[model samples]
Target: MASTTAFIDVPESPDRIWQLIGGFGSLPDWLPYIPESELSEGGRVRRLTNQDGGVIVERLQAFDHTARSYSYAIEQAPFPVTGYLSTLSVHPVPGQTAAARVEWSGSFTPVGVSDADAEELFHGIYTDGLAALLKTAQGWRG
Candidate 1:
């Protein structure tokens, strides 16, 4: 399996960051690329609509609200990978009560692509998503 992890430090408390992104279907709230999300299967699955109107369905694999982390697996998507499992977490930065670290990591089997290419694709996605999350969190009040 190939994997990639991306992270960003934001000037927000871990609780605040988790409040923004801890939900299984909260991607649209922080990730601009995903404009819409609908939950099904009693909130265990999410159907996301991208900016380009592409549909991506995912199933929740695990969640730990106390830890501010969640893991999910792609059920259907246009990505060139399979068995995709991803986790997103918020961690408190030591000595920085007002700051938090957000990490996004994924592992998958490449399909019709090299491991490097797959890693690059997800790394870019995670990095860009985190940047967007930072922007959203910064502008968030409450």
Candidate 2:
């Protein structure tokens, strides 16, 4: 399995950030690449439609409101990945007052793709997604 991780520091409370990130069907609200998302299975699953007509079905595996973290597994995706799982978490920046940290991490095995390509793909997604999340979170405070 290959893993990728991305982290961003923001001037917001951890609880505030978690409220945005923990929304299972809020991808399109912040992610520019995701044009639409449909929630099913009583909001436990989300079907994300990409701008390029690609689709990914993800299921919420675990969520902890108190911990400010959530984990999801990709049931179907456009890429050749297996056992794809991702976790998004918000943490307080110790001694930073209201500052917080957001983390995006995923692990998956490439079915028929090169490890390097898979790594690059995951990294790019996390990098862009986290940047947009930070932007949205900042706007929430304004």
Candidate 3:
């Protein structure tokens, strides 16, 4: 039941930013955390090669374009965790001129003897990823 969330303000339309992050196959292009990602529904696995050369393979649980969100579980992650799910959403910020809100969150269960540290780990994971993504997208907006 652990969870974490992050927000990013991008100076662009929500759809424009979504067009970049929603591609589902361009994570490695901007986010250093994911060296590569192969996206699909239900069984498509996300293969992430971390900066430390560690590999994590997550199973795609759900992806809904209308809701502008996706979820995945750690099928065989290098981390000491299980039952993981990461999700993201985009929204227009009220009263913010040409600004949008990017919300990212996730959680996971501890594996075996490791303390349930998935939520703690994902806090930085999602936050940092969004920062990089917004930075990359905003550069193109101008």
- Pairs of colliding residues, candidate 1: none
RMSD of each: 1.3, 1.3, 2.6
Q: Could you tell which candidate, 1 or 2, scores higher by TM-score?
A: 1
lDDT ranking, best first: 1, 2, 3
TM, every model: 0.97, 0.93, 0.82
Q: Which tens-of-lDDT digit does each residue in 1-142 have in candidate 1?
A: 9999999999989998999999988888889999999999999999999999999999999999999999999999999999999999999988887999999999999999999999999999999999999899878755
Q: Which stretches in model 2 have alpha-carbon errors above 4 Å?
A: none
Residue pairs clashing, model 2:
none
Model 3 is weakest, by summed lDDT over 10 consecutive residues, at: 111-120
Which candidate leads the pack in TM-score?
1
Q: Write the per-residue lDDT of candidate 3 for residues 78-117, one digit (tens) a residue.
A: 6666677787777788997677788887776666644446
TM-score of 3: 0.82
Better of 2 and 3 by lDDT: 2
The TM-score that candidate 1 achieves is: 0.97
The regions of model 1 sitting more than 4 angstroms off are none
* Candidate ordering by TM-score (highest first): 1, 2, 3
